[model samples]
Target: MTSPQPAETRTQKRSAQTATLAEIAREAGVSAPTVSKVLNGRADVAPSTRARVEELLRTHGYRRRRAESTRSPLIDLVFHELESAWAMEVIRGVENVARDAGLSVVLSESAGRLTPGRTWADQVAARRPHGVILVLSGLDESQRALLTSRSIPFVVMDPAGDPGADVPSIGATNWQGGLAATRHLVDLGHTRIGAISGPTRMMCSRARVDGYRAALETAGLPVDPGLIVTGDFHHEAGYRQGLELLRRPDRPTAVFAGNDLQALGLYEAARELGLRIPHDLSVVGFDDLPVARWVGPPLTTVRQPLMEMAEAAARLVLDLGREDRSSTATRVELATSLEVRSSTAPPREGRDVAG
Candidate 1:
């Protein structure tokens, strides 16, 4: 006797036919209600049964017809991590749009992962929200496919990595911000300038660092590798790296801290070394957070409109969900500006040159 054919082979035989829920349930050796549970992302289904049903559904190219009435009155906002004032800005922006649309907001964190977990995709499908706004996060192919199969729309805001051309994304002009921050320091006659960069894995961080290099090259200054240090965009990294940079014998007369937090950390390091801001050393920073202005001497930094970017992402995702059409302008980058304050000035006398 021949062994029973594999599910794939049996499914392939009926590939020409439009697969129904009953057919999928039969193929997976489960009841119709079990298949329905899997389709609805109900947690009651067993993992093994759900996996089998999902595979059969994918194999059969099953697509559940979407009805606007079936969707929940909520907008899902996902973040890579929920730490810092940076996250608060994004939350406020998303909330503003959700409130206007008469929809409640559901927030989730990926816990530092750039891509949310598989369980999140299932939960989202079950919830069937109006749309999803992902901040500093992207979706994997499987997650994307799951959402697409369910007709759920998603938009990425300031993606930590390249979110592919087909994925809609909202971002700030990070390169321009970096350029402006460094140029401001250069214009103040600081030649030996150091830079603190955020994680290179993030496109935004890389772009900002590139802009910093461009500003130096354009102004006829050498880009010293030794003067550039990497950080995790946190105050602790800033303080730790700041100490390392400032302790160098040929320390930069001015330094561009990657973000406001790092800049604050750098301030502490400068104080410990008896180097006063804009007096013995000039400092520039990015992401002019609220604390940037409240610091002892206001921080000279680049202002990225985080809330505005978040609002744009939320709006775009809702538009996509309602229109059910791909937008012509899928990628949007908001402008960033330099916020000049008392922290930067002409490098104190001879401090302009490396000593």
Candidate 2:
């Protein structure tokens, strides 16, 4: 008589042949209810019993009915738009985390809109991603509920709006960054500072503007309402608002822009008026995009650590996926630092740059 074959190998082969859940339960020497709990990842099952049942299911190749395999190694990334260098930075960060984990990223945009379309969530649900990382985006109640029900974890990065106190999210220190940017300008001896801000509805934008106010108050300078203008955080808005600010009789000697794109637009406005950087006027911006360094005079701006924030969000979502139930909501705000480049200096004495 031949020696008995290894039990696990024999079971593996049998599973490949076609084994029902009942058969797996019988082989694992557990009741069907216990086996069901293990299959569903229910916490009520004892560790040893769940392990035994899982081993049997793995060996027997049992596929749960009407459910996609939970082992999908794909991560979904949702963005408001992928057209900007800032967006590219975020993508690179997420990709770095995904590559290390032996996973791939699927990119989605909200139809070139800030708010996601209703069907976008449904499509994501259908894909059954292992996890999701949303950049400057949000989910409605139904969408959030759907993902939760399916055990798909997600994290928000630089959420466009308030992501709620209970939602997991990662963001930069926008308020601190704004304060630093304005403070840098003030330290350079420019008291008459103007600011072109991003959309007021976005939390990040509001926080940044608030920081600017805080810095001004700390320095004993009254916040000038006329000097602050709201824009959409684009080159056009920056150029338009920059022109308006520069045209004033008591033009600001230094201007703080919400982002790098807007800063470049300000550069154009200053150039049009024949004003020399750091000599006639100084400028500061947020989000030190690569273009900031390559400009005529490198931009003095706030470095928001976009890539690091994205990486953190991606890692958090994956970790949430592995956990049965995270006890508390997670929120992370990476520090933002000032990058002093060649774009700022003290106001010129005796003569107004705008004239």
Candidate 3:
């Protein structure tokens, strides 16, 4: 009898049983093109058909070829939450690039969480997409490892936290945006400025808040702790914080909101309290979203290049997917500019009283 093969050799032998595209297609009762679509994580595939194909692929122990040959024609776009105008801007940007590259985009949400669930990595590996782009999120160790093992590259867009020094990411100059917003209020002759900040846990939030403080200090204004409040970067939180700030007898003549959503909430609060925009209080918001211009009297806000950042991220991930990937970590931060509009003006004297 032949000597028993080593345990590692036997395991490798078992996993080496790979099936061809035609074989997988025949077994799944689908055309070769359908199998190829499923393998590429194309969004056009039907749920039932994709599931059947994926199951058949797993059963047959199918493995994709190395990146040196060819790559899947799909890109994965994962988001922390899918319910916002912000998300839409990013999606449009990525879609623009993917369309030019003749690649399909696959969208997935992390269910309102900072990171995706455990099975997310496995599902992505099974599909073998060309690349992955995560918005306001990061991958865990195992997820990173899984993608690395399969030679699939990933990029982070506006990461929520420290994405480590090695990971590539795209973001805007949030600090400069915050500084510009606050400085605009100062230039409008507002000595007292209150700020509504996003969650302290997020890097963007902290950067904006820091810039606000820096601008205040630069103008020889005292940075009052009471003038600053943290928010969850939502309309509800903005509304609640706006009520608090506007109710104060020593309220500031102007308020700088961390984002457009919060600024809109502040507008509602000011209306309920019988205050007039620019006449009684001036507000500045960040992100300069489309609604910023459509709001009543329009919003004077900092314009962040969200779509451009997304497009850059999409391009970067695709570049990383090439056979000869760059070892250096690439970090790109787009510039931010202030869009002066009708929402801001010189503060009216004696308008700091409760609104």
Candidate 4:
């Protein structure tokens, strides 16, 4: 007969098999009830103690076996901000998926921060939604840990930053869109082209700018740093930057506005300077928003499938929550195409194509 195993060794084996709330509490130097409160996301728990308990739970790979009845019939849709019409397209997409799934959507904003606050995480844990879909927003390590412990899956859409390799995400082919936009301008005989870019911190924005550079390089055109102006993906920033670019002594005959809104702003600036669309200045924009078509002259733009991307993100998050499904990190980028319209044209007669 084999000798009995040591008590300490036996305890270790039990822990490996199943980490209990009491064991986690003991490791965290807190009471079992306190650990439960943290797990349940009770607001009464102190921030410091809650964080400690959460860390311990994560360290032990603790996963709460939640009952089906415990989850709310809802999907959480979070955003960094809800300031633009661009958000409306995303909302419509998520809403379509959520409606078909028989689940309502809970919308939240991080109020300009890239990551939602701790309070938002706590609220999410308490509500126990089926899954979460974040648009242009990310989560902190602690927030991710909290969601993981509760087995609540999340997917990022058009991530503002590099959402790690382990995070599921959905985005558009921004680089390809940018490259196509610039190439179209070049093909139109506009050699001196300018660009208005979105915020530099955003990966999508950076990729778009990079594509623009690539297009110019391939065309044997000079990449003039002085002509690329940075904007905040807002109409005002576009208007302001457009003015600055147009005021230059050697202004570009064509410009690629990062998105449709900026393109509109650029339109306003051109009007103020007595320039005619496709005549004095040719312009291209991205995100082919509906307003792009209604504007004075239909705006030439890149079509990013915003609605489709949001729908995919929502569906992916729900799939991750299914026990039978694998929750591997998945990144999907939809294709972007250029929609040539009346906004772009050949450079004027006197403009130098080689300049």
Candidate 1 per-residue lDDT over residues 122-152, each given as its tens digit: 9998999989999888998778867766768
TM-score of 2: 0.79
Q: List candidate 2 stretches off by more than 4 Å.
A: 1-69, 324-329, 351-355
Query: Candidate 3's error at 117, in angstroms?
Result: 0.8
Off by more than 4 A, model 3? 1-65, 68-70, 324-329, 352-355
- For this target, which candidate reaches the highest lDDT against the unseen true structure? 4
Q: How many residue pairs clash in each candidate?
A: 0, 0, 0, 0
TM-score on alpha carbons, each prediction: 0.90, 0.79, 0.80, 0.91
Give the lDDT of residue 300 in candidate 3.
94
Q: In model 1, what are the clashing residue pairs, if there are any? A: none
Q: Write candidate 4's Cα lDDT for 99-159 as tens digits.
A: 9999999999999999999889999998999999999999998888899888898999998
Q: In candidate 3, where is summed lDDT lowest over 10 consecutive residues?
A: 1-10
For candidate 2, write residues 91-148 as lDDT tens digits.
8999999999988999999865766775666566556677888888888765665455
Candidate 2, backbone clash total: 0
How should the candidates be ordered by lDDT, best one leading?
Answer: 4, 1, 3, 2
